[model samples]
Structures are given as C-alpha cells and as structure tokens.
Target chain A: MEKENIRYSELERLCKEFRKTILKIITEAGSGHPGGSLSVVEILTTLYYLHLNHNPKNPFDDKRDRVVLSKGHSCPALYVILAELGYFDKQELHNLRKVNSILQGHPARVYNGGDEVKFVPGIEVSTGSLGYGLSVAVGMALGFKMDNKQNLVFAICSDGEHQEGSIWEAIMFAGFKQLDNLIEIVDYNKLQQESRIDDSVSLEPLKEKYISFNWQVYEVDGHKISELDTALADAKKYKGKPKVIIAHTVKGKGVSFMENNVDWHGKAPSKELLEQALKELEGK
Target chain B: MVTVLEYKPSREGLGEALLEIADQYPQLVAIGADTANSTSLGKFAKKYPERFVNVGIAEQNAVGIAVGLSLVGKLPVVSTYAMFLAGRCWEEIRQSVCYNYSNVKLVGTHAGLTVGPDGASHQILEDIALMRVLPNMSVIVPSDANEAKVAVKKSLEKVGAVYIRLSREKLPVFTSPEEDFVIGKAKLLREGSDCGIISCGVMVYESLVAAEILEKQGINCRVINMHTVKPIDTEAIINTAKKCKCIVTCEEHQVYGGLGSAVAEVVIKNYPVPQRFVGIKDKFGESGPAEGLMLKYGLKAQHIVETVKEVIKYK
Candidate 1:
C-alpha cells in the first residue's frame, strides 16, 4: 500500500476540527451521542481522509472499499467526515434527528413505501441495534472473496458492542472462512452509555477472546493518527486470518470535562457546555 | 372416499427449486445456520459448494450476512428452522434485510404444527404473523411441495426481501407442478356458493378435502389457497366473501395472526361476512406424531368441515 501524502500534523488538525463540529451538531440537534463520537475522531479521520480507497463522486462504485459503523450512535463523527468529503450537502448536517431528515439518528438508508429512496452516501448499511454490523461486514467480505475481488470491508464497533453474542458469532465465521479482507476496529473507550465496562458487564479478556476465535489481534492508541494508519494499512495486507484493532481511547477525547465521563456517552451538550468544549478544542 | 395422495415434505420442493434456478441465477448463494440438510439447503450446498455458507447455528448472523451478501450484488438465500430463523432473529431480519431493502430470501422450514415431535420449542406457529408484519417483507406459505417450488423460484425474480415458510412433515402433494405462482394471487381450487374456505400451507390440502366432504352433504364450499400471507390477495378474499357470504379460515397455525386474522381483516373491511377460524386456539403444541398433532390441534380436514358448517349458520 502506498503512503497517504497527508502529514501527521494535518491529520491532528482535522481531529480537533472534527471534535468541535461533533459537539456543535449534538448541541444544535439537542440530542445525540457525543462521547463515542469524540472517542473515534482520529481513527475515522485517518481512515476516511488517508486510508480508505473511496471516491465522493462515485460512492457506490463496485471497486470501492466498504465501511460499516457498527457502533452507529457515534454517527455524528461519521456524518462530519462524510459531509466534509462531499458525500452529501454540508447543510443537511443541521437536520440530524429532525423528522424528514435523511440523516437519521443512527446510520441508515431512507426508505419510502418499502423502497430505498435516499440515504447518507458513505453509510454502507443501516445499523443501530448492536451485534449485527460485523456479521454484515463479514458477509460483504465473503462476497468479495467469492467474486475474486480485492476490495476490503471495514467494520467499526464500540467496545460495549462486543458484549453482543452476535459479534462473536460473526468473528467465528470470519476466522473460520479466513476472511483476510474483513477488518474490525473496536472503539475501546472503556465506558458504555450508563457506566464503564469495568463497573457493569466486564469484557476483561477481550484481546485473548478474539485470538481464541482465530483472529489476528492488534491493540493501539486510538487517538494516535499514525498508529491507526499503520494498523489499518497492515491489517489490509495480512492474509489467512481476520484482523481486529482494539483502539484504546477516552470516552470524550478533546473535551476536558467530558473526557472519561459516562454521562456524556449519549447526552448532547447544552449551548453553555458546547461553548466551553469548543474553547478547549480551539488550540488543541 | 378421498384417495391417498403422494406425500412430500415442502422443504423438498425448496431444494428442487434451488437446483432448477441455479444456472440461471449464477449469483445465487445458499446460507444455512447449521441446519442445512434439515432445511433441504444441502442440495444447493452439494452442487455449488463454493456458493454455500453454513453460519453454524447462528440465526442472527445468518440474517445479517444475507443482508451483507445482497448489498454486494449476490442473491443470498438463507434458511433455518422456522422457530430460530423467524423467532430468534426477527429484529435482524427487520432492520438489516427489510428496512435496508436488501435483496435477500429467507426460507423458514419446519414451520407451523407440522414440525412434529420437536414440540412448541421447534415448531414456529407465529412466523407468518411475524414476517408479514415487517414492511418490504413478502410472506409466502406454500400449500404443498409444488407451490413451494414455484414460490421460491418466483420470489427470486423480484428485487426485495421474501420469507418462504415450508413444513417439515411429509404432506399430501396436491398442487400441480404446472401452475404459475403470482405473488398475492390466491388460487380458487373449487368454486362453490354455500361458503368459502380460505386456507394456506399444509391446511390448504385439508380445506380441499373438507370442501369435497361438504359437497357430498349438499353444502358446496369454495376452497382457496391463500398462499401469500403478506401482500395478501385482497381481491380474492373480497370476491369470495361476496360469492359465499360466509367464510371459514383453516391453517396449521395459531388462529390469532395467521391466515385466519389476515382473511378476517380483508373480509370485515371490504365486504362484511360471517367467518369462523379452524386452528390451534392459543396453545403450545406437545410432542406427538404429525397426524396426531394436527388432529389434537383441530387442523385436519374434519375440523375444517366442522368450522365451515359452524360459520354457515351465522350467515
């Protein structure tokens, strides 16, 4: 794989911009998941701007690599990058959860009369209910392998989503089938919506769990753009087994008060809180 | 005396249909949730080994994968026992497949009371109700083996989600192999004026037999095969209500949300008519022979005949 021409400084700058925009939208919408959105800023920024082989013009091109945001509540982050990359009009971002908006609260395709009329261009599948997106990604990878295509499928799941039994079910199938084309990146922010993973249901042996299921595991600092870029590039080349990058990140990365806080997991910031959060992100 | 018909499980027709249409639809793929042979998807797996995927007892993953495969231009057919496929993975089917409008075919074998000896745990009496409720999901319960084959093949021709319910028991094969399957088009097997018998799945055979017995008793009954539960043949249902003025719904499922409720919805709205239902009256099925269970659940020909007489009095 060729190196992405963008420098680490440029990627870091975009992460700050993404964090501010994510908080602003959540505040405007009056309800959205901000903690998980802030957690995966660098990971998504690196993938969309640097790593993924996608075109904003031909979003559904057959040769393009696919991405499934399994932890869909953090879609404010995804929506920002997609709009910046011209997947849809940037103005549509304001109508995030409003009725008749194409941007659903979760990642989804708009369907009318049982027909898909419109959808956010970059979103590969409609997902909100956890534990199902990995299976969908595995299916896509298997389909690509069947057709002898080289396109890869990336599935981004939250650490809390690993609690779903279907995630392991998909992992088992991907490993058994030797789907080297499927890469799963877990946003390991430690905290779920109500509490931390340690206080609630603990997924302590998470790394060994994937290895036992025949997956090649890689752990990295999720906020580090270069590390995520490296792991993503290597996972793309690794063969004979599925790959999962456990991305360690804070609940809210740039925001001072919201960082590591469980209450920010799904709550939108008020205007006063939003201004303070944006001030914290201004120079970072 | 009614002649004994050749018996064949509806799952067999599903297998035959896959083989029949495999060459034409080269992108056709079969996915099984560890019950490949039981659901008769083994036939497709045997011939097209590369195209077959056994997800290994994970019904939710099977549905999610089927949706994924559909997104990438493959016609993925996923089958498992009805209880697991429809009951366990209902939300997956709704969100990934139907709500996404993925072109996936879901085949639920061992449906209704015909899945004998497994008891209520394995038999799915609520699949029709469960599947029919989802938007963009077309639910089809074939009357016999031949119609099951047509339903499977025809369902693939369209570009949306479809749920085909098949029975595990070796049922009497009465539907013709030559008949064309049009979705939402009910087949009126016998025309009569005394009363109408609307039925689906294995109970269609029972309804036909019941109509025969009613004819001998000078009470002619109209027997209809209401195969497609969703996108129901409302015209057939309304016309039957007008012609007969009385209706009796027969099904090998719970009387609540299966063919009985569907027919009643159409009848009571379009043309109000007196109707009676012949099915399991909200009870779990116990372990027994298929024939014995049908008798105990009041889903046999005799039960349909009795229900028809009961509804005619209300007319």
Candidate 2:
C-alpha cells in the first residue's frame, strides 16, 4: 500500500493540534462527543498522516483507502483531519453541527438539501447508528476484492458499538469470506453514553471473540501514535483474513480533568473548560 | 377484462430480472440474508456466483453491506423476507441506504398475508409504511410477475434507493412484458367512469376481477396498477378522482399506511374525492393457506366490489 512519509514527531504534533481543533469546534457547536473524539485522535492521525493511501485532491479515486467512522459521534476528529489534509476548507470546521453545515453531528456522505447542507467530501458513508459502519466496511472490502483491487478499508469502531448484534453478523461475513483488505480499529475506551461498557453490556474476551470468527486480532495502546502506526502497517501485510486492532484508549484522553471521564462522552466543553483544555493541550 | 397470461411468484420475476439485467449492469451485485431460494435469488446466485453474496440470516448486515457495495460503484440488490428486511433492519435501511442516497435496490419478498402459513411474525404488512416514510427512498410494489420483472430492470437503470415489494405465492400475470415500468407511474388496466379502483401488488389482479364484476352490473370501474407506492402517480390519481364518482384503494398491506393511505393522502389533498380502503384492517395476519388468507382477510375481488359500491353511495 502507498503511504505518506510523515515522521513520528510530526504525527505527535498533529495529534495535539487535532485535539485542540476538535475541542474548539465542539465548544463552538454547543453539543458534541468530546470523549470518544479525544480518544481516537491518535488512531485517526496515524492513519491519515502516515498509513492511508488517500488524496484530498482526488477524494473519489478508485484506489484510495476507504475509512468509515463507525463510532460516528466522534466525527470531530475525522472532520479536523480531512480539513487539514485539504479535502475541504478548514473554515467549514467552525460550523460543526450548525444548521446548513456539511459537518454533521454524525458522519454523513450525502446531505439532503432540505437543511441547506450538501454532501461532505471524503466521508465514506453515512453512519451514526452503531454497528452499521463495520458492515459497510465489509461490503467495501468485498467489493475491492471482487474487482481485484488492492485498496484497503479501515473501519474505526467503538467498544460500546460491539454490543449491537449486527456487528457480529458483519464480523462473521468478513471472516467467512476472508476479507484481508479490511482492518478495524476499535477505540476501546470502555465507556458508553450513560455508563461504563463493562457495567452496561460487557464485551469481555473481545480478542478471543474476533479470533473465533477467523480475524487476525491485535491489542495496542490507542493513544500512542507509534503503536497505532506499527499495528496498521503490520495488519496490512498479513493476508487471507481480516484484521482488528483493539486500541485501548482513555475517553477524553489529552485533557487532565476529562481523561477516562464518562461525563465528557457526549457533552461539549464549556467556555471555561475550553480555555483550560486548550491550555493543557498546548502545555503538553 | 385484461388477458391473464400465466401464474408466477413475483419473487421469481425479480430473480429472473436480475439474471436478465446482469449483462447490462456489470457493477450489479445481489446480497441475500439466507433467503436466497425463498426470495428467488438462488437462480442469480447459481449463474453469477461471483457477484452474488449470501450474508446468512442477518438482514441488518445484508442492508449495511449493500450500502457499502453501492458506495464503491456497485449497484447492490438486497433481498429477504419483508418482515425481516423492512421490519427488522429498518434503521440500517434508513441510515445506510436512504440517508446516504446509496444506489441500492431493496427487494422485500413475501409481503403481507400472501406469505400465508408463516403467520403474523413472518408476514409483513407494514413494509410499505416503513419504507415510504424514509427520505430518499422509493417504494415499489409490483402487481404481478411480469411487472415485478420490469420493476427490477428499471430500478437498475435508475439511480438512488428503491424498495421493491414481492409476494411468495403465484399470481396471474395480467400486464405485458412490453409495457414500460416507469417509477411513480400507474398503469391503467381497465378503464371505467363510475368508480376508479387503485391497487398494487397481488391485489391488482383482484381489482381487475372486481372491475369486471362491476362492469356487468352497469358500474364502470377503472382499474390501475399502482406499482410505485412512493413518488406515487399523483397525476393519474387526480385524473381518476376527477373522472370517477368515487375511488377505492386496494392492497395486500395494512389499510393504515400502505396503498390506501398513499392514495388518500393524494385524493384528500389534490381532489378531495370520496374514497374507501380495501385492505387488511388493524390486525395481525394468522396462519392459513394463501387463498384462505386472502378470503379470510377480506382481500378478494368481492370485497373490493363492495367497497366501491359503498364509496359510490357517499359520492
């Protein structure tokens, strides 16, 4: 697979900047998921900057890597990266979740003109409802395999979303068909909207579960850009089976008060918290 | 009366149409959720093995996969029992297929009481209502095998999302293969002026029979095959309301949100004509033979004839 030659130091710096932008946009929008957005920043940054074979100039290229944000509430992270890569104007990020903004609360492909919003370029498919993105990624991987194309599909999922029965259904199909080009990065933050994942519906033995379905499973620290980069690279080389990286991450990773906090999962930072969070990110 | 050629399940029409249009649409793919033979996609699976996918008893995953296949320039056709496809995985259809405006064809087979022995749990009478409510989704209920085949072919020619409802049992093919199957266009089968009968799916044949029975009693009835339920033939409905004394809407679906409600939404707004609904009442379908189910549910031609007469009195 073709990859961009960005250094580890550069990816680290980009993750910090992406975190600040994600916080700013959510605070500006008045309501958004900050925890998951913060948790998956390193995972998305590593893929967009170093691992993915994608181009902002030709967003619809036949061979470009397709990334589906299955945990759709965390689209602020994706929106920031797509904009920084010049997929769209960065100014559009300020209008996140605003009426008539292309950046919806959830990742959307084509926006109906009813709300004065249109399609968002670089967004693979519309996904807000959980457990849908993986299946879609499976479909895309299947399509690429049928066409004999080498393009890979990267699906970023959340731990809570695995509770949906449809996710297992998709996993079974992808496993049975041996979709080698599909790689899923589960942001294992261990928390959902209202409660902890283990307290809610436990996804214990997660690694063994994927292995049972014939997936090449790996566990890594999601916040470490180096670990994510290495796992994604190694997974791409393995063939004859789909790959999944259970990226253990902290909800609201970068900020001191927000890290591992469930309250910040879907709540936007207040003006005071925004200033404090930005200062914490800059100091780091 | 129109010439009835042959009796065939509408699912066979859709399946055969998939085989026919495969050459024309090289990017076309079929996805099924363990209903390959039941939905009649088995023939396509056998011939075009590479392009066919059996996702196995998972309707939500089937729809989600179709959305992905469609995103990557493949015209994906997904089929399963209507009860599962429309009723079970409705959110997947809403977000993945309809919300994204994915060029995916959703074929809901064994719709309504026609599924017969499957009982209420298997028979889906609310698919039209569920599909029609979604934005960027076109709902199509074919009247017979020939029309169902045409619907599948035409759906591929067009872009965006479409829901094609089919039946399990064989019905008389009243329409010709040569007839053009335009989306949202109603086919006027029998022309009359006394009352206009609007029907879709298998009920179209029953409506034709009812029109014939009424014609003998000096009550001229116009029978229309309303194949496309959403993006409904508003113009034809207005014209029917204008020409006829009253209108009767017939379908194998529930009377609440299927063809009857679609026609009423048009008539009450566009022409404000007197209308009667001839469909399943607010109730679940019980297990029975197809013919007995039709009669027990009051879905026969006689019921339609009676509804037309009752509505004509109001007119």
Candidate 3:
C-alpha cells in the first residue's frame, strides 16, 4: 500500500479505539458529555494522528500545531486522544473526574501526578466554557502567522456555540484577517442538553452562513474516515481564507441506547449501562 | 525610539509602545474592536500588519482571541474601549484571560470620565472595580505618557493576565523617561508627613497638584501613585500611614471599589488610620465636558485638598 493509503487505515483504527476509550472513561466518571465526544472522535483522531504536527514527548514543542477545544463540556473525547498521544499515562484514564485527580469536571491546567508536568503539551488551554474555542484558535493562528510558522491552528466548537454573538464576531474577524492557516470543526450533533438545536435555536443555513462570512465551508459525515480526510484536504486547499468543517454527526455514535440521545449530554452511564457499553465496544 | 514633544494622551503612548513590542517580539499581537483609531492601535496595525487583528466592535471576541494566542505560547495584547472591554466582555476577560491564566495583556483605553464627548455610555467608571476583583489579573492605571509606555511594556513581559487602563486625555508627564516602573510597586512622586494622598491615572497628576497646596498650608501631605490596583502595595500603604498618620485616596471612579477602597482595605487591615475617599460618590455621571464632570463628581485636585483637610481635622 502507498504511504498515504497505509496512514489512512491506521487513523481509522485509531478513531474506533478512541471511541471505545471515550465511552469507558465517561461511563467510569459517571458524569460527562458522551454524545458530543463520540460525535467528534474522527475529527480528533485525524488531527492527532495525521493533520497536526505534534510530538507526544515534547507536548510544548514550539512548532507544534495547536488544537483548541471550544466545546469544552465534551472533553472526554479530547482527553482520550491526549492520553493516547502520550500526554499522560493511560492508567490515569480510570482516575478521571475523581477527587484530587488532575482531570476534573472540565479540562483544567492542573499538575499531573507522575510526570512533574504543570501543563501537558497536547492539551493547549484549560477550557469548558462554550463559544470561546474559535477565538483562541484565531489568536493562535495569528501568532503562528506573526512568527512566520506554517503550522495550522485547529479548533473544535459546537453548533450550540454558534448561537453566541461572540462566536460570530470571531468568525468575521478570522475571515477579515484572511487567516488561511486556521481551521474550525463544528460538531453538528443536532442536540444540546435538554433540547434539539433546531428547537432550541436554529443554526440553519449553517454552511451558507459560514460561506458568507468568507470561510470555506466543508460539510462531511464526521464519523467516516474518508469524508473526514477529504474535508480537511479541502480546507487546506484554500490558501487565503479560514475554513469551517461542518461535520454532521449523531450525538452518541456507537452504543445503541445513548446514540442520538440528548439525555447523554452530561448524564453518565449507569453501572448496568456501563457493562453493556463495555461489552458492545469490546465485541468490536 | 521616537521622541515626543509636549503632552500626548496615554493611549498614544500605549499605541507606540505596543508597535515597538510587536517589533521586538514577533509573538506580540494586538486584537481590538473597530476602535483601533480611538485606541491608537492603528500605528501598531500599520507597523506589524501581520500581528494586528481588528475584531470589529466585538469585545468578547477580542478577549477570546487573546487567550487562544497565549495558549499557543504567543503573547497577545488585546485592545478595546474601556466601557466594552470591562462592561460588555468582562466574562470573557474573566474566563479566557484570568481563569485560564493566559498571558493576555488587555489594554483598556478611554477609561474614566476623561473620554469626554463619547458621553457617559462610552466612559467606563466601573473598570477599576471590575479589574481589581478578578483573580490573577494585574490591574494597572498609568499616570502619564512615559508611565503608560513603561506599564504597557511591563504588562507584556509579565507572565500572567494584565489590564492596563489608558487615559484618553493629554496630561503632563509624571515619571521621568529613565525611571523604572515596577509591577505592583507604588511610586512616590513627592514626600511629606501630614496626610498621604494615594492616586492613579491622570488623577496622580491631580494628587501632585494637591500636594503643593497642602505643603503651602503647612499640611505637608505625601503623594504616592498607587497605579497597580491588584497585588496592591500594602507595604507602601503601611509605610505611608506610619509616616503621614492619615490617608486620602482620589480616583476617576466610584468611591466603592476603585482606588479608594483598594487603599482602604490595605490600610484597615495593616495600619489603623482615618481614610477619606475622593471619587465618584457611587453615582452614574452625566454627559458633559470632562473638566466639568471631574469638578462636579469631586474627582479633582481641589477635591483631594478638601478631603485632606477633612481627614486632617478628624486626626
């Protein structure tokens, strides 16, 4: 197989593994946003495995590409990826959201116990607040541009986060500056906590909304590896404007009961549900 | 290294210093609303075109971008009008900048009633109160052009979130060009022994004027520039109280959490002294000339003199 072809399947495998890991950690923690985490697993996996130029050991590598988590509530997904990427020991995954663990309700800049690390490299900023990731992404992109580095800044926000006027302000500013090196991934999970996004606040004409703001919009099935790669490739093709990948995805992707459900927004799986989820994931 | 003649607004000093810092460090980028001209960031925008980000009238967005840049190991200087940066986008300033401990320098221009014609809506009276209350946020109010330049540079070099309140009006230079402006240290412009007058922003100059009148009246008041409100110089306040016996604080903000309250908190805790506050008396100001507003609100050198006399009577 060609190098690109070999790398593609490797990333696909990583995505599946990441999905299983996210489910395990969230089920153990007993309180997390699983649906959103599962929805963006492919985007996170692809960025970690292929797209972003980052080193697992030297997390703060000066030239490493930055990834901002705008939808911070859905951190179980990114936490799994960072662990797989070697930010910390995989053993720490089970200790997540426990008292005194570095991993808290939301991702924070806490001192990890084993590594003598104050802030892990792969984890860029401590975040959980909504409608903020894109702005930080713009800041990082502008910083790289200022330093004449060619690395791109990727941010993962949510459809609900788009309802924020601040998010649009960042979008327009990123568009106005023509920051081609910036890429934003909006996980259109269709459901926010307690309500469907359309019923809550319509983000309709979403793709056109981004296109009008001068962002190159790329819509794709966020779970499919091929679609994920193609969308990212297309975003990179545009060299003079920022790009937004509107990945249409189900809320909870893998497990049956949690799939496409708003109840899984921050509700952890029950002990019985956890056993069932682990059985299905392990069977795969 | 451009030299200036006569008086210049503190915001102009900030604009020039920022461009110099951006030139010195490639990572220093400035984000703003549509007020680049009013904030005087247009020069920085022109000089380092790649580093300037105009977020068009969105204060919340501007703060968010600054945090993102800091996470990527880049120093970001976010510029916006005082009213919006503190009043409108304060939550972003809190979460993104302070809570995250991002190395984001927030340059708040047109602070106080001195913003003048922009009216009460544009003027920010609660900024000092807001900034002083935030954790890990170093709040600075530079007294003059030289001090503004020094404070702006200091905020960029410091390793945490910082807020530098810039004045819109032109004022006489308080600090000499060669004087060092340390973070959290109070600058004593004049030394006396009856009453200690602590002030910040253009009001520092006002306090200096108040000192001269007090000296002639045998009041012998000591004036200290308490510029950095948070991590406030408690040691200096104690030192002033020990020497001067009484204290009076004057600022272009409410008497409630502005410079007065900041000083009073330190004095009451460390040294017991009679403290008089000369500021906006917990009221929203009306639209008028800046000078008229200062007099009406009792935020001037004369007000400081009267407060000093009143505190002296109590002593």
Candidate 4:
C-alpha cells in the first residue's frame, strides 16, 4: 500500500461526491437514511482515502485494517464507498434495499445468485441492531493483538446508540483489556430517530465518561478532513488505552433543508429535494 | 441394564474436554462472563491464561466478541448461565454468530430447573427453544457427564454456531466412554415394544428409570436419548413412532418449546402418533431442593412413567 499524503482540497471534493452518491441511491431506493449517511461522509472519506490500509481488489487480505459501520442505517454511504473501491459493481448502487441486492438495508456479506455462495468480501460483519459493532471491533482488535499483527479495527457508532447498556459494556471491556489498536468514532450529530439526543437522553460530559472508562478521547469537527486526519493520526500513535474520536457533525450535511432535521433520519429525499441536493453538491 | 457411574456436573465435563483438546486446536479460545468457576471454565483459564477471556458479567459482549474472534480464524467457546446467555444475548447471538455462520460455540450451563436452590431466577427452561429457532444454529443437550464431554469436543470440531445446554447439578453418567457421540444423531438407550420415551439432558436418566418401572408392569417402553434438539433425528423419531405406535417426550424444561415441542413437530409432520409430554407446565419454579423441584415440576421418573402409561393406552 502506498502512503498517500493528506490533501484537504481532494478530500473536500470527494466528500461532496460521496454525499451526491448517497442521495442518488437513497432516493432511488425510495426509503433510506439520508441524515446520518450525509453526516458520516467526510469521516468515512478521510478513513478510506487517507487512513485505512486496505486493498480494493483483495478485500480479504489478512493484514488489512477493518472498518465496521456500527450505525448500519447509514449504509448508503458505506455502500457507495465500497462500490467506488471496486468491491462490487458500481451499478449495483441503484439496487439498494431491493430483494437479492448485495446492498441490503444493513451491511451484510453479499451472496452470489445461484449457489448462494458469499462472494462480496469487503463487509466485515452484519450490523443493524445498535450497540453490537463496538464489541465486535474489540474482539477483532484483540484477535489481531494475539496474532501479533499490526492491523487496526475502527468502528463508527451513533450518538443515540450510546443509550444502549451494551455499548457501555463494550466500552468498559475495551478499556480494562487495554486494546490500543481499536478506534471508535462517534458520529455525534446530536439527533436521534425521535428527537435530539439531549432532549431524549442526554450524553452531556460524554468525553468525561470515556475518560472514566480509560479511553483516550478527542473531539473533532466531523466535516473537516484535516482535523479528522490529525486526530486519527494521533490516535494511531497512542499506546496502552483505546482511543475514541467524538466527531461533531450536522445530521444532514451538505444539504440545505435537511440539516439538523430529525425527520430525515430515515426518510429518503423527495424527487424535488433530490434534485436540489444534487445541485447543491454539484455546485460545491 | 443401566450402569451408574460416579456423578459429575456437565459443566465440569465441558471444562475437561476443552483442556483435553487445547493442544490439538491451538486457535481455540475460551470466553466467560465472570462465571468461570461456576461454569467449570476455571480449569481452562488456569491452564491457558492467555487463551481465556473474562468479559466481566457481560453476556452480550461475550457473544459479540466471540463472533469477532471467530472471524479471524479462532474458535471461541463462550460460557455463561443458560438464562443470561440464551435470553440476554439472544439477538447478539442471532446477528453476529448465527447470521454470519461464525464458528462460535456457546456453552450455556445451569440449564433447566435443576439449578436447585438458586431457584427460578437462575434456572433457564427456554434455552432449547431460543437456540433451535435460529437458522444456522445447532442445539445440543447432553444426557450426562460423559455425553457433555463428547458434545464439547464435537462442537469444537464443527464449523458453525452451536449451543450446548449443560446442567449445574451433578448427573449420573449413563453413557459409556466407548459410545459414539455425533451431532444431530439420537442414541437409543433401551429396547421395548409398548411405547417410546424420548428425552434429553438430565431427563434421560429419569426416562431410563421410568423404562425399568414400566418393564416390571409388563409395559415395555423404549428409552431414547434425543440429545441433539435442532436438526433433530427425524428418522429415529419416525421409526420409533412406527414401532411403538405411541410416544412420550420428557425434558427438564418447559413443555411449550423444549424437547417435547421439538419431538411433536417431527412426529406431526412425518408420522403422527398419540403423544404425551412429561415436563414443566407453563409456570415458573420456586426455590426448593433439586429433587423436590423435579418432583413438583413433573420432571421425575414417576411423571415419565405415568405419561408412558397414558400414551400407551392410545396404542
């Protein structure tokens, strides 16, 4: 793998393209999450383009770093990234949420048509229910450590999922085990499905909570690639304790009307709104 | 004739079996939810500290972590109480282990009402039902200590999600060391002509005792250890139904979705027969002596004998 230097201009352009691709698929699917998907674009773009050590052709490479979309409802963003990386055909993006499509509502290993053999390999694990991906990531990191491998396990979880008790269980276990190779990025858009996270269930002093659990915590501007790059780089160098990046972002980023709107959490854009979103992203 | 060997908890057998096979399968790992001594995983933890992981009373995390470990070419055996493992971590097991077809072995100890003085809160009577419903899951209820050891060994070699239901109380070893243990295969304990008693777990011992009482009364009842609950031995069930003309299913679990329900499903679909279930009714248990709870919950040999007699009348 070639070491690519961080370029903010190129990442900014890629982030716009990712948001456009997400809008295209979610609108085509008729019912998909646009808010969280748009919010996670720059974070995912920075990881895939700059930080993650992976190969588009050989996804099953043992030494490759892994990224688990803990907030799996935002799979339109992940599906677009995987398609761009040649894990599957880019045209399959239109078939999102359709029966027999590799891209299901949640991220899952794709099966071939006739024999039902699992062929699409980029997906690490199937995650839809909240609060499961972090523990799975901890397991992977522990396995890599046991084998003396340098591979890192990164997981992106939602702000609302923090309310789940199991998420705290994972946090406590990762801290006690001292899994320095694991990194958790919270897409803290402040809004859950029903309402704002603070109104529903407050996670105030969230960084303090992670610190109490012995995690090295960092808060970053989620939309800015440069800040995310620096935070991720710093997290990689830290030893002993696991690291968490609370990426502060807007729910529906890059779009005018949907920004911070809880209604867009799971609803797809209307035909007119889709056209507007595409125009805004294209103008960027 | 039944051979009564020294009694041992099925959980101890599981621990010993893992120790026996640890050298062969170097990639095998043991995970516990702070119940190492209770689940008999302390032996493995003592011998191989590096391979053992104590997730600290978190059953859901234990299951999810096992799935992750299995993905990286390591076989993980996760241990916890039956109620917590099958109830609390059910969705995690369904999504991470069963859905992904991960090679994760889930050992649920303290299964059924035999958990004794700890009472209904600790007892788990619905684990069999919870595990058998999953698509890629294999459910096993070992009949005794010897069978539990073999079941653990077999689960390690098989490459998919498996749930092994073990007992906390010491059970008499009815199975011989020479007996072959295979997943999804039923072991026939006694041969008779009037009726057949199909049972699993500790209930198998009571079924054997019931067969003896029935034999003295000129009612010859065959005894079958139907240990593998999922992918049940449908052919054995059908054949027994044909030979006996009636069936009596027994288990130390709820009659609704446990061994009895599984047997009825096979019998109704393949070969319909007049049947009766000898297990707990739809009611919770309370704190009591193990033997008293077994008798009160209708899980004893006398209950199996009565059920056999009633079902044989239909023949």
Model 2 DockQ, alpha carbons vs. true complex: 0.84
Q: Where is the poorest 10-residue window by lDDT in model 4 chain B?
A: B170-179
lDDT string, candidate 2, B1-315, tens digits: 668898889889888999988998999999988889999999999999999999988888999899999888888999998889999989999989888888999999999898899799988999999999998899999998898899999888888899999999877887889988799889988889999999999999999889989989999998888999999999999999999958999989889988899999999898998999999899999999999999999999999989999999988
The lDDT of each candidate is 0.90, 0.91, 0.83, 0.90
Q: Model 4: iRMSD?
A: 1.0
Worst 10 residues of 2 chain B by lDDT: B1-10
What is the per-residue lDDT of model 3 for residues A1-284, given as tens digits with 9 covering 90 to 100?
48877788888778778887888788788788888888888888876776778888987778787788888887888888888878888888887889757776777764444455466446676678888778878887877777788888888999888988889988998988899999999899899888899998899999998889998889999887778888887887789999999998888887888887888888788778877887876676
Instruction: Give all TM-scores, in the order shown.
Output: 0.97, 0.97, 0.91, 0.98
Instruction: After superposing candidate 1 on the true structure, give the runs of residues whose Cα lies further than 4 Å from its correct spot.
Output: A1-6, A111-116, B1-5
Q: Give the docking tier of candidate 1.
A: high
lDDT of 1 by residue, A1-284 (tens): 23344588777887898888889888999999999999998889988887799999989889999999999999999999999999999898898887777788998865352244775588899989998899999999999989999988999999998889998899999989889999999999999988889999998899998899899999999999889988988998899999999999998989989999988988889899999989889967
For model 1 the local lDDT of residue B118 reads 85
True contacts kept of each: 0.78, 0.83, 0.74, 0.69
Docking quality of model 3: it rates as medium
> What TM-score does model 1 achieve against the real structure?
0.97
* Model 4 interface CAPRI class: medium
**Minimal lDDT window, size 10, model 1 chain B:** B1-10
Per-residue lDDT of model 1, residues B225-312, tens digit only: 9999889999999999999999999888888888899999998899999999998888888888999999988998998888888889
